[model samples]
Target: MRFLYLLRRPPYSGSLAAEAIDSILVAGVFDQRVSVLFKDDGVLQLLKDQQGQLLGHRSVNKMLAALPEYEIEELFVCARSLAERALSLDQLSLPVQVLDEVGQQTLIAAQNVVMND
Candidate 1:
Protein backbone atom coordinates (compact mmCIF):
# COMPACT_ATOMS: atom_id res chain seq x y z
CA MET A 1 0.00 0.00 0.00
CA ARG A 2 1.06 3.55 -0.55
CA PHE A 3 1.22 5.63 2.62
CA LEU A 4 1.71 9.35 2.79
CA TYR A 5 2.63 10.93 6.10
CA LEU A 6 1.93 14.64 6.25
CA LEU A 7 3.80 16.29 9.10
CA ARG A 8 2.65 19.75 10.11
CA ARG A 9 4.07 20.12 13.59
CA PRO A 10 7.39 21.42 14.76
CA PRO A 11 9.92 18.85 16.03
CA TYR A 12 9.91 20.30 19.54
CA SER A 13 6.12 20.43 19.76
CA GLY A 14 5.62 17.49 22.04
CA SER A 15 5.98 14.02 20.47
CA LEU A 16 3.95 14.32 17.30
CA ALA A 17 6.91 14.54 14.96
CA ALA A 18 8.63 11.57 16.59
CA GLU A 19 5.44 9.56 16.51
CA ALA A 20 5.03 10.26 12.83
CA ILE A 21 8.58 9.13 12.15
CA ASP A 22 8.00 5.95 14.10
CA SER A 23 4.87 5.22 12.11
CA ILE A 24 6.74 5.83 8.87
CA LEU A 25 9.50 3.47 9.93
CA VAL A 26 6.99 0.79 10.81
CA ALA A 27 5.31 1.16 7.46
CA GLY A 28 8.64 0.94 5.72
CA VAL A 29 9.54 -2.19 7.63
CA PHE A 30 6.39 -3.82 6.31
CA ASP A 31 7.59 -2.99 2.77
CA GLN A 32 4.95 -0.38 2.16
CA ARG A 33 5.51 2.41 -0.31
CA VAL A 34 5.89 5.39 1.97
CA SER A 35 6.27 9.08 1.34
CA VAL A 36 6.71 11.94 3.80
CA LEU A 37 5.79 15.58 3.33
CA PHE A 38 6.85 18.36 5.66
CA LYS A 39 4.61 21.38 5.68
CA ASP A 40 4.26 24.58 7.75
CA ASP A 41 6.28 24.42 10.95
CA GLY A 42 7.05 20.79 10.21
CA VAL A 43 9.67 22.02 7.76
CA LEU A 44 11.67 23.05 10.79
CA GLN A 45 12.27 19.38 11.42
CA LEU A 46 14.51 19.33 8.38
CA LEU A 47 16.65 22.26 9.42
CA LYS A 48 20.30 21.51 10.10
CA ASP A 49 22.05 21.82 13.48
CA GLN A 50 19.01 21.00 15.55
CA GLN A 51 19.77 20.79 19.28
CA GLY A 52 16.99 18.38 20.23
CA GLN A 53 19.00 16.88 23.07
CA LEU A 54 19.11 20.30 24.75
CA LEU A 55 15.35 19.96 25.10
CA GLY A 56 15.56 16.38 26.40
CA HIS A 57 14.40 14.92 23.10
CA ARG A 58 15.96 12.54 20.60
CA SER A 59 17.52 14.25 17.64
CA VAL A 60 14.92 14.60 14.91
CA ASN A 61 17.68 15.14 12.40
CA LYS A 62 19.18 11.75 13.18
CA MET A 63 15.79 10.09 12.99
CA LEU A 64 15.14 11.65 9.59
CA ALA A 65 18.54 10.54 8.37
CA ALA A 66 17.48 6.92 8.88
CA LEU A 67 14.57 7.09 6.42
CA PRO A 68 16.74 6.26 3.45
CA GLU A 69 18.03 3.14 5.15
CA TYR A 70 14.45 1.94 5.43
CA GLU A 71 13.96 2.58 1.69
CA ILE A 72 11.53 5.42 2.42
CA GLU A 73 13.01 8.00 0.08
CA GLU A 74 10.06 9.97 -1.18
CA LEU A 75 10.59 12.98 1.01
CA PHE A 76 8.96 16.26 0.10
CA VAL A 77 8.52 19.76 1.49
CA CYS A 78 6.17 22.65 0.89
CA ALA A 79 7.86 25.28 -1.24
CA ARG A 80 5.82 28.11 0.18
CA SER A 81 6.53 27.00 3.71
CA LEU A 82 10.27 27.15 3.13
CA ALA A 83 9.98 30.54 1.43
CA GLU A 84 7.92 31.91 4.32
CA ARG A 85 10.58 30.75 6.73
CA ALA A 86 13.34 32.08 4.47
CA LEU A 87 14.90 28.63 4.18
CA SER A 88 16.56 27.31 1.09
CA LEU A 89 17.27 23.69 0.20
CA ASP A 90 20.85 24.21 1.33
CA GLN A 91 19.60 24.96 4.83
CA LEU A 92 17.95 21.55 5.23
CA SER A 93 19.66 18.47 6.62
CA LEU A 94 18.03 16.22 4.02
CA PRO A 95 17.34 16.77 0.37
CA VAL A 96 13.62 16.93 -0.35
CA GLN A 97 11.57 17.65 -3.42
CA VAL A 98 9.90 21.05 -2.99
CA LEU A 99 6.23 21.04 -3.89
CA ASP A 100 4.06 24.01 -4.66
CA GLU A 101 0.32 24.24 -3.90
CA VAL A 102 -0.81 22.38 -6.98
CA GLY A 103 1.90 19.79 -6.60
CA GLN A 104 0.96 19.19 -3.01
CA GLN A 105 -2.65 18.70 -4.00
CA THR A 106 -1.69 16.26 -6.71
CA LEU A 107 0.49 14.26 -4.34
CA ILE A 108 -2.21 14.06 -1.69
CA ALA A 109 -4.65 12.98 -4.33
CA ALA A 110 -2.36 10.16 -5.48
CA GLN A 111 -1.90 8.67 -2.06
CA ASN A 112 -3.70 5.50 -1.01
CA VAL A 113 -3.65 6.67 2.60
CA VAL A 114 -2.83 10.06 4.07
CA MET A 115 -1.98 10.52 7.74
CA ASN A 116 -1.58 14.05 9.07
CA ASP A 117 0.27 14.96 12.27
Candidate 2:
Protein backbone atom coordinates (compact mmCIF):
# COMPACT_ATOMS: atom_id res chain seq x y z
CA MET A 1 0.00 0.00 0.00
CA ARG A 2 1.11 3.57 -0.65
CA PHE A 3 1.45 5.58 2.54
CA LEU A 4 2.08 9.28 3.09
CA TYR A 5 3.39 10.23 6.48
CA LEU A 6 3.07 13.91 7.29
CA LEU A 7 5.36 15.13 10.00
CA ARG A 8 4.25 18.52 11.37
CA ARG A 9 6.13 18.96 14.63
CA PRO A 10 9.70 19.61 15.59
CA PRO A 11 11.88 16.61 16.39
CA TYR A 12 13.09 17.78 19.78
CA SER A 13 9.73 18.16 21.49
CA GLY A 14 8.73 14.49 21.59
CA SER A 15 9.08 11.08 19.99
CA LEU A 16 6.72 11.70 17.10
CA ALA A 17 9.52 12.33 14.64
CA ALA A 18 11.45 9.38 15.99
CA GLU A 19 8.41 7.14 15.73
CA ALA A 20 7.77 8.27 12.18
CA ILE A 21 11.35 7.54 11.23
CA ASP A 22 11.12 4.14 12.83
CA SER A 23 7.90 3.46 10.96
CA ILE A 24 9.55 4.38 7.69
CA LEU A 25 12.43 2.05 8.42
CA VAL A 26 10.12 -0.83 9.21
CA ALA A 27 7.99 -0.09 6.17
CA GLY A 28 11.09 -0.13 4.01
CA VAL A 29 11.99 -3.53 5.40
CA PHE A 30 8.66 -4.74 4.10
CA ASP A 31 9.19 -3.01 0.71
CA GLN A 32 6.30 -0.64 1.24
CA ARG A 33 5.87 2.46 -0.89
CA VAL A 34 6.34 5.10 1.80
CA SER A 35 6.68 8.84 1.29
CA VAL A 36 7.44 11.36 4.02
CA LEU A 37 6.24 14.96 4.00
CA PHE A 38 7.88 17.55 6.19
CA LYS A 39 5.61 20.42 7.08
CA ASP A 40 5.55 23.20 9.69
CA ASP A 41 8.18 22.79 12.40
CA GLY A 42 8.89 19.34 10.99
CA VAL A 43 11.21 20.98 8.50
CA LEU A 44 13.60 21.47 11.40
CA GLN A 45 13.91 17.71 11.49
CA LEU A 46 15.85 17.88 8.23
CA LEU A 47 18.09 20.89 8.90
CA LYS A 48 21.70 20.23 7.94
CA ASP A 49 23.53 21.71 10.93
CA GLN A 50 21.60 20.28 13.85
CA GLN A 51 23.22 20.24 17.29
CA GLY A 52 21.05 17.63 18.96
CA GLN A 53 23.99 15.54 20.10
CA LEU A 54 25.37 18.56 21.96
CA LEU A 55 22.23 18.37 24.05
CA GLY A 56 22.63 14.58 24.33
CA HIS A 57 19.85 14.04 21.81
CA ARG A 58 20.08 11.85 18.73
CA SER A 59 20.09 13.74 15.44
CA VAL A 60 17.46 12.75 12.89
CA ASN A 61 19.56 14.07 10.01
CA LYS A 62 21.40 10.78 9.76
CA MET A 63 18.09 9.01 9.47
CA LEU A 64 17.00 11.49 6.81
CA ALA A 65 20.09 10.66 4.78
CA ALA A 66 19.52 6.96 5.19
CA LEU A 67 15.94 7.08 3.88
CA PRO A 68 16.92 6.60 0.26
CA GLU A 69 18.96 3.54 1.07
CA TYR A 70 15.81 2.13 2.59
CA GLU A 71 13.96 2.96 -0.68
CA ILE A 72 11.91 5.74 0.94
CA GLU A 73 12.72 8.29 -1.74
CA GLU A 74 9.46 10.13 -2.30
CA LEU A 75 10.41 12.86 0.18
CA PHE A 76 8.63 16.19 0.17
CA VAL A 77 8.63 19.48 2.08
CA CYS A 78 5.84 22.00 2.05
CA ALA A 79 7.02 25.26 0.52
CA ARG A 80 4.88 27.44 2.74
CA SER A 81 5.95 25.52 5.77
CA LEU A 82 9.63 26.10 4.98
CA ALA A 83 9.02 29.79 4.30
CA GLU A 84 7.08 30.11 7.53
CA ARG A 85 10.10 28.74 9.39
CA ALA A 86 12.43 31.09 7.48
CA LEU A 87 14.13 28.06 5.99
CA SER A 88 15.05 27.36 2.39
CA LEU A 89 15.29 24.15 0.35
CA ASP A 90 19.07 24.42 0.50
CA GLN A 91 19.06 23.63 4.20
CA LEU A 92 17.75 20.10 3.84
CA SER A 93 19.89 17.05 3.13
CA LEU A 94 17.20 15.08 1.34
CA PRO A 95 16.24 15.88 -2.22
CA VAL A 96 12.75 17.15 -1.47
CA GLN A 97 10.01 18.01 -3.88
CA VAL A 98 8.43 21.27 -2.78
CA LEU A 99 4.71 20.65 -2.32
CA ASP A 100 2.55 23.69 -2.84
CA GLU A 101 -1.14 23.56 -1.89
CA VAL A 102 -2.32 22.05 -5.15
CA GLY A 103 0.41 19.47 -5.02
CA GLN A 104 -0.50 18.63 -1.43
CA GLN A 105 -4.15 18.18 -2.35
CA THR A 106 -3.22 15.91 -5.22
CA LEU A 107 -0.86 13.88 -3.04
CA ILE A 108 -3.44 13.27 -0.34
CA ALA A 109 -6.27 12.66 -2.75
CA ALA A 110 -6.17 8.87 -2.93
CA GLN A 111 -3.29 7.71 -0.79
CA ASN A 112 -3.57 7.22 2.94
CA VAL A 113 -2.34 10.52 4.42
CA VAL A 114 -1.14 10.06 7.94
CA MET A 115 -0.59 13.25 9.90
CA ASN A 116 1.68 13.26 12.95
CA ASP A 117 1.01 16.33 14.99
Best by lDDT: 1
What candidate 2 gets wrong by more than 4 Å, as runs, is 113-117
lDDT string, candidate 2, 14-110, tens digits? 6677777887788788877888888888889999977768766778887778899988899988999998888888888778999998898888775
Per-prediction TM-score: 0.98, 0.91
Kindly list the per-residue Cα lDDT of model 1 for residues 1-117, writing each as its tens digit: 889999999999998899889989999999989999999999999989998999999989889999999999999999999999999999999989999999999999999999888
lDDT (0 to 1) per candidate: 0.94, 0.82
Every model's Cα RMSD, please? 0.6, 1.4
Kindly give the number of clashing pairs for every candidate. 0, 0
Residue pairs with clashing backbones, model 1: none
Compared with the true structure, the alpha-carbon lDDT of candidate 2 equals 0.82
- Per-residue error for 62 in candidate 2, Å, reads 1.1
